[model samples]
Target: MANELDGRVAVVTGGASGIGRGIVERFAAEGAKVVIADVQDELGEALASQAGPDALFHHTDVGDQEQIGELVATAVERFGALDVMVNNAGISSPLRRGLFTEDLTEFDRVMRVNLLSVMAGTRDAGRYMAEHGGGSIINLSSIGGIQAGGGVPVYRASKAAILHFTKCAAIELAHYDIRVNCIAPGNIPTPILQSSATGEDRERLERFEARIRAQMRDDRPLKRDGTPEDVAEAALYLATERSRYVTGIVLPVEGGTIAGKVMARKAGSEIPANGAPS
Candidate 1:
C-alpha cells in the first residue's frame, strides 16, 4: 500500500493527535501532500515536520465555519489541489451521572465541533471538488452514534447526525464525482474521554472508563482493543482510489463491537443441542 496516494492532496482536521494524527501520518507515508489542521499548533507543527515536506500544519478551529473554509482554501493554495478532506476534529460531551442529570451545558460546543464542522467541511470541500475533477471526504463518527448509550448523549447525537448527513451529501455530490463517507470507530483509547472530565469528575470518569473498556473487551468479538492505526487504515481506504466505487457508506472499525455480543464458550467446549452452547 505504500505510495497508494502519491500526488494526492489531503486536509485532515484534528490532525495533531489520536486517530486524526494517525491518518495524517499514514497519508503522508503514502505520498500525499497533507495539511494538518488543528488547534494544537505545537503538536500539529511537530507532526508536519516529522512528516517531512509532504506535510504542513495549519492552526484551525473547526468549530468556526469561517475557519473551516479557510482550511480548505489553504489546502488548495498550498498543494495546488484537494483530493481528500478528512473532517476528524471533534469534542466529547461531559459524562453526567445520567441523561436526566445532564444540564446540556456542552451541547452547543459539541454540536459545533462534531456535527457542524463536518457539514462545513463537506460543503467547502465539495464545492472545490465539484469544480475540479472530484475527491473523497471522510467524516469521523463513533459507535456510540450507532448504538444507544446512556452517557454522552450529546456526543452520540452529534455523531449520528454526521452519519445521516454524510449519506445526504454523498447523494447530492455524486454527480460531481465527490465521494462522501464516514468511519465509526469504537473502543480506541484517546485523550478525548479524559478531556471531557474535570478534577474529581476525572477520577470518576477514569473508573467509569475502565469499567466500560473491560465490558467492551468482553463483549467485542475480536477481544482486542482497537488502535488509532486501525481507524487510520480505514481512512486510507476511503481516501485512495481503491474505494472509487464506495460512497455514503458508514464503515465501522470497532472490532465487531456493534455486531453483537461475542458468544462466550470454554476453550474446548462442545456444542449443545438446539445450537445453543451450554
Candidate 2:
C-alpha cells in the first residue's frame, strides 16, 4: 500500500478536515505528493506540515473559479504534475423544518461551492492532464443526491448535478486518458453539518442528527457509522491504477444504507434524503 501511489501527485480540496483530510493523509502515506486545498488556512497548513515535505497547503476558496484555476497552476508548479484531482470541497445547505420553511437563501453559495467548484476543478485539471498524460479525477457526491426525500434540497440538487457532470466530463476527458469518477458517502459523521448550520438551524440540525443516529440502530443494515477513512479507501482505489479502466461511476461508501434497510421491509418505507456526513 505504501508503494502503491509512489511518484503520484494528488490534490484534495477541503483537505483540512473530514473526508478530504482522510484522503490527504492516506495519499501521503501511500507515497503520493499531496496538495491540501481549503479556506481553513490553520487546519490545512497544520495537516500539510504534519504530512511532511511531500505535502503542501494551498489556501483556496473552491467556490471561486479563479482561485480553483490558480490552485491547479500552483499544484503543477509546486508538485511538478497533477496525477490526481479530487474535487471534494463542499458546503451543506441549511436544514429546515421542511420545504415550506425553506427560503432557498443558501442556493447561490451551495451551488457555487458544491457544484461549480467540481466543474471547474475537473476542467482545469483535465486541461493539464490532457496534455501531460491524463490522470484520475474524483468528485465527492452524497447519497442525498441518489435518494429523494426532505431537508437540504439545494445540497442534494448540487450533489445530483455533480453525478451527471462527472459522467459528461469522463466522456470528454477520456480522450486524454483522464479517468473521472465519484464517491457518494453516507452516515459518516463529519463536522460539516454542524459547521454549515448556525442559530436556529443548529438546534433543529442537532435533533435531526440525533434521530438519524437513533434510527441507525435498527434501520441501517450495518448499524455502524462510516468514517472519513472509509471513503478515503474508495478514493485510494480510484486514484491508483487499480481503477484505470473505471470511469464515470459513483461509488457509495455508505454502510449498506444506499441499498436500503432489509430487516423490516415495509411498503411506503422512507429513506433519509439529507446530505451525508462526508
How high is each candidate's TM-score? Answer: 0.94, 0.91
| Model 1: per-residue Cα lDDT at residue 22 | 95
Stretches > 4 Å off in candidate 1: 201-205, 266-278
Evaluated against the true structure, the overall lDDT of model 1 is 0.93
Residue lDDT tens for model 2, 104-136: 999999999999999999999999999998899
- Output the worst ten-in-a-row residue range by lDDT, candidate 2: 269-278
Clashes of 1: 0
Give the TM-score comparing model 2 with the true structure, all chains together: 0.91
C-alpha lDDT (0 to 100) for residue 174 of candidate 2: 95
Candidate 1 local lDDT, 116-182, one digit each (tens)? 9999999999999999999999999999889887888899999999999999999999999999999
